[model samples]
Target chain A: MDLAEVKRIGALARLDLGEEETAAMSDQLTRILDYVAQLEALDTTGVEPTTHPVTLGEAFRDDAVRPSLPTEAALANAPATDGASFIVPRIL
Target chain B: MAADSDLARLTLHEARDRVTAGEVTSAELTEACVARIEEVEGSVHAFAHRTTDEALAQAAARDAARPDPLPPLWGLPIAVKDNICTQGLPTTCGSKLLANFRPVYDSFVARRLEEAGAVILGKANMDEFAMGSSCENSALGPTHNPHDLERVPGGSSGGSAAAVAADECLAALGSDTGGSIRQPACFCGVVGLKPTYGRVSRNGLVAFASSLDQIGPLTKDARDAALLLGVIAGHDPDDSTSACQPVPNYEAALEAEVAGLTIGIPKEYFGGGLDPAVEEAVRAAIATYESLGATTVEVSLPHTEQAVATYYLVATAEASSNLGRFDGIRYGVRQEGKDLLDVYKRTREEGFGAEVKRRIMLGTFALSAGYYDAYYGKAMAVRTLIRNDFDAAFGQCDLLLTPTAPTPPFRLGEKLDDPLTMYLSDIFTIAVSLAGLPAVSFPTGTTAAGLPLGAQLIGRHFDEARLLAMVHAFEATGQGRPLPAL
Candidate 1:
């Protein structure tokens, strides 16, 4: 992968990188991608992919209203919180 | 309590028996562990965050209660991997992103430990976001191998295993996505088990790979592993993927007899990166089992060569998704930017370490438009073949034995520059994670240099009982469990 591709991935992944990091990431990602390329030699035709190890039936929980965490307690760890809401950068 | 109290070194079960017999109080045991931690923690660096006061208070409470028929883990101090959430305690995942973050509630495993009456010593260090095979990736700081100070304790569960080996805690909880538990347990000369996927709840674990992560025990021996596993294994309503299979009395399954049992030797696992010392130690284990009346059969996991590549694809892809929640919104360290999008980019940029960022970028690239099918999809398909290989092997033998890591404990900074080389460290342990089978690693012997050697025993899905039994059988001969001279 090239620096441009790495930049694209960084942006896609919401990671703002410095010039040095971008260049380093590009080189490392290239090597990793090339290493994983060994899989192309395998004939996996008609094989169903296993997304997860176990395929369990849907789980159901009781449909009863339970007391949830208090708003102050839930927001305790937030970097920026205004009592009940978590504050973040403006979207608009 | 003396700074070097031997009570701190007692195995989890031994401590439990003493506590139940009233020979020693929980407070004294807790003090012994605390004294031991104070003496060794500066050098070992095993804990990410120490809960000394909380542990003392918890231990005193256990002493005060003094209930008839004490609980199984009552008063035993155990270290938990930092990735698992503890109520109002720092669960950093060894990353700066969550450095100041604390879960408002306890994880399922934490709750189980609490109810089982076990005292939690602290949150143990790990590879940042549980990404690297060495603890060097931890943003907090690296944990050194207790066996040899200059060598690395394997990751991402390095701190957990080191804590157990150093006797900072009697046992520890470690989460394994790809050899995180077993590899370190091997390097540190302890017992580590990765239960079958869905065997343990993932409710409180900080996700690295949702499909692959499973929490298990790192302890002094197979009996401690079984006791700890029994407490943590079973279904949780909070975790939808947790299996509904009945939890067995794993401790009861520990027997010295290996008669009528068949163990598989996966030929693909031998040679190549396998160190001669590790191979010889593993071969000796096989011979010991043979003498105990077990038969050994040759088996093959032909797709073993592709496991690391597939694991990187699968684990990183899942990590990218799971970590997207770390955007500069609700919790953790955040950096301000012009807008919401810029905020996310900057917060993550400043928060994640080099290894965590690398995996994120790779995962995003793989899942990006046009590349998903080639990278992620192909990996999943290859993963199926890997699982099929295990299925075929299990069809021949009840268990599979191999080296936990290709080599013994490596020097700390040995593979830091080469990510591919670091990834290969988990080669023996990765495919088992991919197949979602249960496996355990116990010390086999130490090399000529005194570095520990570990052999793995893998069992069928949900067959942790048989797997622990086999390890116990060998352990009964006083064969493994080499104590680190640390």
Candidate 2:
């Protein structure tokens, strides 16, 4: 991975990394990517992917109403809140 | 005061008996720990937040009740990792982003401990979002290893393990995603158990890698691990991933016969880069098992080298997704911007530390449009082979034994700059997490320099009972490291 690629990835992740950080990430990510490239040597043909270690197929629960977090409590931590709703910057 | 100090040093199971017999008031024990924390926390930096006042109050209440048959965790003062939420206390995940965030509700694991009458001493420090092998990544500050203050208490569960080692808390709750709990326990010379992936609920363990993460116990001894695991391990409707299977009486299984057990020694684990002292201690541990009539066989994990590479991709991808919940508007410290996108970018940029940022970008790259198939998808497929290796090995042996870490506790800041080197520290412990098997790290012996060297015993899924029993049996042999003089 190059510095430009690292910067692009940072942008995709919604992170505004500094120039030095991008450079470091570029060097580190390149090493990590190169290391992981060893996996390509092995043919994983017909092998099923293991996403969840223990795949508990769809945990079901009763469709009954339970107490939910109060709006005030949820909004309490908001950086900008007007009692009920969180205030976010204007979006298009 | 001497009574308090003595009580502080007692292991969880030992203290439980004393408390049950009315030999020591919970107040005395709690005060002892509080005093100990006050004394050594200056050097160890084990806790992110201390709840001495709350813990004392809780202890007083437990003494007042003095039930006929005490609750399992009655009078036990324990620490919860900062990542696990506790309603009235802050849960930081050792990050600046959630540094001031007070959880409105308790995590499933925290609730279980409280329900069992355990007094939570505080939240332990960790690597930011449980991202690093050493606690140096914590925004709160690094946790110094109690044994050698200049060295790291292995992490991202470093504080939890350190607290238990220093007797600040009888035990602690730590989450393991690629050896976080066990490696630190090994470094701190304590017993740490990482239960099967779904064995314990992950309701509020701030997700780093959801697929690999499991909550476990870090305690002074194997029996304590069993006691703590029993309290926290069970199905919860709150966590869909929680196993519905019964939580076995881990304590009862302590007398499990190791005589007929077959322990596998992975040849790959005894390879290059493994410290000679670590290998000797681990080999001696195997001999000790042999003396108990347990036979050892060599097993191979052909995919061992690729495990770390595969883990970074899989874990980073999951982390990037999970961390999306930390956008500026909802909670935590946020940097304001002209618009929503700008706010997110600025908030995350300022909030996250170096290691966390590196991982987010790495993960984003893996899951990005053009790279997903090559990186993330390939990693998932390789993860299968890694898991399959364990399943095949378990076919021949009841458990697998390996050195918990390649080396003893390294000096603080030694591997800080090199992320790949830090990642390799968990080599002995990571594959077990990938396989979602139950494993425990217990002190085998110490290096000549007196640092802890641990042996890991990996077992089949939901086989924590047998794993703990074997660990208890090994600990019973009394060939272990002495406590660090904090």
Clashing pairs in 1: none
Give candidate 2 regions above 4 Å deviation.
none
Best candidate, lDDT: 1
lDDT of 2 at B174: 96
For candidate 2, give the lDDT of residue B223: 87
Off by over 4 Å in 1: B1-4
Query: Best candidate per DockQ, number?
Result: 2
lDDT (10s digit) by residue, model 2, range B1-486: 356677889889888998898888788889889988988999999999998889999999999997777899898899999999899798989989987899888899988988888998999999999999999999999999999999999999999999999999899999999999999999999999999999999998889999999999999888899999999999999888889998889999988989989999999999999999999998899999999999999999889988898999999999999999899888889999988999999999999999999899889999999899889999999999999999899899999999999999999999998899999998988888888899999998788888888999999999999988898888888864459977
Local error of candidate 2 at residue B3 (angstroms):
2.4
Lowest summed lDDT window (length 10), candidate 2 chain A: A50-59
Give the TM-scores of the predictions, in the order they appear.
0.98, 0.99
Residue B126 Cα positional deviation in candidate 2, in Å, after optimal superposition = 0.5
